[model samples]
Target: MADRELEEIGEDNTLLLVDDEEPFLKRLARAMEKRGFAVETAGSVAAGRAYATARPPAYAVVDLRLEDGSGLEVVETLRETRPDCRVVVLTGYGAIATAVAAVKIGAMDYLSKPADANDVTAALLAPAGDLPPPPENPMSADRVRWEHIQRVYELCDRNVSETARRLNMHRRTLQRILAKRSPR
Candidate 1:
């Protein structure tokens, strides 16, 4: 971060870190704290709502999907409670549709999962419109298709049979595709 940004982000600044993934949330909270934020964490949408309702943080990192519901619900609530607070949506199963919805609902930025503390800080500090440009070498059509299939598979409760049926894919074929890690 620039010295100007460091100066702006005071040691007393508070942040809400929400994600269903326990390890990720804890690790990120620690990292952000080291960078001078006072971090509070929640592992579900319900908990996040309660926390935000009680004390809205100056910044929030919300996972797109939580245990009880979409993190978009938390973002919407935060926006209503404290319009000035900056919120960023983070998701492993990122989709253009969800990203657009997050922004429209008042998220300052949307980031794919595994974003580092530096990235989150930068996004929160920069003017909402001053986002870094989209990647040049974006995912290919086949890669996009693979990602979408994986997301659906998960959404279908990780039921291989149901996912195959929904995609109209041969059960064995679907399993084969899922057996491998996502294509670059």
Candidate 2:
């Protein structure tokens, strides 16, 4: 799949990434680079579109929301200009409606946020509509709860008090959860 897109653009190893979260962008960019993509990142739809116009990527991972505009705009632009490019849309606010809309607008896959490099890689490179194999060791309920708490905590702008308030949890308990490494 990548080879075919590569042939069209003649840009080996290039990928366009659009996301508003700086930490996630940095982490995923590094991961993708380690996996062999020469990642070019943008934090907004406008920046992504401009970059695509100048040098369209053979692959893209676009977040559903950005600071300046909808990630759908980036998807539309890629579909119009680089139809062969493989695109995966990731979102924190995952919904059936939005997922359907993303695919209808030209995204090859729609993934929920907190997706690891392995998940993104598989989605980008897998045959359309084919799901990856299930994890060998799925998380237990406790682990899942912990992860969700962490996500919400981060979303609350890392305010322990706010996170606790939102989760209806004690501040000290939330801090304890944050301090512990994730359980397998």
- In terms of TM-score, the best-performing candidate is 1
Q: What is the lDDT of candidate 2?
A: 0.85
lDDT for model 1: 0.87
Task: Report, for every candidate in turn, its global Cα lDDT versus the true structure.
Answer: 0.87, 0.85
Instruction: Give the residue spans of candidate 2 off by over 4 A.
Output: 1-11, 134-184
TM-scores of all candidate predictions against the true structure: 0.86, 0.68
* Best prediction by lDDT: 1
1-184: candidate 1 lDDT, tens digit per residue? 3567667775548899999999898889998878778899999999999999999999999999887999999998899888988899998777999999999999989888667887788787777578565654566677778878989998899999999999999999999999898777
Task: Provide the lDDT at 132 for model 1.
Answer: 69
